[model samples]
Target: MSADIPATYTAARPAATAEVSRQAWLVWLTSERRAARLTVETYGRDLAGFLGFLTRHLGAEPTLADLARLTPADFRGWLAEAAADNLSNATRAKKLSAVKSFLRYVERDHGIAVAAIGLVATPRARKPLPRALTVIDARAIATEIGEVSDVAALQARDTALFTLLYGCGLRISEALSLDRGQAPLPGSDAPLRVMGKGGKTRIVPVLPLAREMMARWVALHWQPAGDAPLFLGARGKRLDAAIAQKSLRTFRRQNGLPEHATPHALRHSFATHLLAQGADLRAIQDLLGHASLSTTQRYTEVDTAQLMAVWRRSHPRA
Candidate 1:
């Protein structure tokens, strides 16, 4: 039997209308609602993709009626296609959220009601448990930094970096993005200013050891001009994220820690250890810069495990 001939598919391109798209984007930015820049950018991109899809698949610009005609089943089909193409649930949810927001914006700004767009529900994702290093393992990894004798400055930098990660629960990106000009010395009782996600900034207290390590490194390699990368690479460039991960992996393997040991694990350890020591959930939420209390509640699950272990050991009814 002869194989069936493949059908050719042709995508339609919409005529360029830069003016309309630009006006829409500008309105999104200047609107009184005060959305985050990242959110605006993300929604803009998602809406553009949907518009492109309409032109490509249906050979016409998408009218409000066109969007209104879509069923939840149709949206689910699109989401399935995205998943089949290897998109993560987080990415899919972001895109769907963007589409929903855009639909709302069109209704409010242009007086076009596309009710069907609201039917697309985002996929639910389970929040993974935070991975953390044990206190002994964290100290052990720090000790191995001293073994890198060939690069004494790097030893101090790595020690301080890891110390801040576990000590203050800083994301690796936040720690590396620090500049020398931004308050070299954090006061003994004060919190260090850290730039977090979506350009939001937060204050995190410094551990004495972390502070000492940072001060010593600064004094030895300190340049009077405060406008340089806080942590420099061997070539005097800003340290890259990959290098930080590689260093952590090497230290974990050398010190016999679990394979899951990562820079993020230090953050998890910081929260977990704090919860064990009776830190309030709300305070932990503030420290982590979580937008929702439910996000901070996950750490309590870590605390629960610890509580169960103590109960088993101390209870006489066992």
Candidate 2:
């Protein structure tokens, strides 16, 4: 079993064949599938729960053959139990998805088809719309976030990071992944190349203000090297996403910014503001590096919601 799959999750031990296949499936997920560590762990726990249920339902530890013999009713019973436990629809859907993925893997890799499991329907969950900060708030965050840091370089780094996030609509992970050599400078017209989710690469234009802040931070970089991380922690290692998030949290509390004013909100603000200004939806999709235009379309919903709020306040109609 992968070390990432904790040995102590709420699970009954599977029979030998099931245990071996489960271990192999997890290895495939982490290695060949390139699934994120957290994703793997969550799926692992979901599968563990399913196995525990099977152990009780069958009156013995489940085996590969037992998984193939599972009926849709068995799956429904598990869903019913989860619903009784007060798991949200979204949580139940995710658990169901994990179970299906594992079953698919078993069929493909081990030639042990659990065709009955495929008959289960996934619970529908409403995806929450992206919450964007007002333009005034986004601009204020990019400018004032640095105040949370006393060290001049740290201040510049935080300011630069937030500026880039808003200006280029880069995810925090994508921004933190950049190297010193990829840093943009003032007057450089070349667009910044970002490696986004699923290892997809896309180039985004960097505004002059973002470039200016980045240049300032680069100037104060400690022992800078071409291959070194563009963003650094106090210990000179690559900055952790958690640390950057905490800095924003601290700044928000100090400045009374909305609780939703997060690093990601800056990215959401970028796309929403652009959409409101009549930028092409397709172009915004490319800039955001979204594989599907539907994903980028969420910004339109945010934009429409903002417009409705403005109209409601101004129309003065009873």
Candidate 3:
């Protein structure tokens, strides 16, 4: 009877395995009440990896019960072992993230209660200070881009893009993604509409220099369509972030700016300059699309450091 057992079992097994994965994905998607689609997808991939690991190491599929039995200590042991294997902090963090997310999904979807996974404590990553050029360095880089007279159109475009970034504190992605009709510049009473992180929309005031540079670029191109990209590539396509970074690099090299100069440095410079000018921290947070004033407050620290440096140089005391 065992020898006569059907090939149908083998065929049905594959289908059953696929169905289980599909159901796991769906459960992950639908289980969390407030989870974003992207979050669900990320956790789904993580859970899948966890399940795969269980299959390999334990020689049995892990159920919600198996996950519930996991403690923070167990998770930490896994992380420590991974680190001992010379895995980078980033990779180990990603793996732990997958484990933690799976445990949460098991609790939510399978009604299996586990202790809070946050107790596992992810590895602390060093928070690098934001790199922002000094106002003089910013002006020098902008001037270098503007002075590339061999390509008038490209020069105007780069000048306007960097001006919008540094002058108005716009993200490089936001500036590149601007639509043609979104302009005529925000009036003193009205702020410009900007789409920021997580598809949230916010209004930011347009500075005079940003308005003037944009207006000049628009006049030069004369594209009347409302839906056209505010900044375009050679073929009139939306400007790519990589291309903008490359252009900034060329300008940086020509102008002798520091090695850390990047498009984002302009944004950092914007916030730092605003703080130097006594702009409110909350107001700067709104302009820079920072979700928290704490994030914006880093620029205040930058401003404070600069003030201290100046005081040390100018003070009569040694």
Each prediction's whole-model lDDT (CA): 0.73, 0.89, 0.72
What ranking emerges by lDDT with the best candidate at the front? 2, 1, 3
Q: Model 3 segments beyond 4 Å from truth?
A: 1-123, 185-190, 307-318
Off by over 4 Å in 1: 1-123, 183-188, 309-318
lDDT of 1 by residue, 1-318 (tens): 234533211111123232354346547565865778776766677777666766665567755556656677767777887789898888888888777766665556545566766666778775777766688887666555545435778888888777778888889999899887753354566678888998888888777778887876676567666778888787888889899889887766676779988888888888888888899999988898888899889888877876787799999984
Flag regions of model 2 displaced more than 4 Å.
Answer: 1-123, 222-224
For model 2, state the Cα shift of residue 185 in Å. 0.7
Q: Is candidate 1 or candidate 3 better by TM-score?
A: 3
RMSD of each: 13.6, 11.9, 11.3
- Candidate 2 lDDT over 176-268, as tens digits, reads 999998999987899998999998899999999999999999989844478899999989899999999999999999989999999999999
Expressed as tens digits, the lDDT of each residue in 1-318 for candidate 3 is: 266766644332322342264356556567745667776777666556556655655567755555556667756666776778787777777777766655555455445566747687777664556777899988766556777546788888888888877777778898888889885453443567889998988888777767777777887787779998889888889999998888888777877878888888988888887777888889888887888777877777777777798899999993
Residue 103, model 2: Cα distance from true site in angstroms: 23
Following a full C-alpha superposition, what root-mean-square deviation does model 3 have from the true structure? 11.3
What TM-score would every model get versus the actual structure? 0.58, 0.63, 0.59
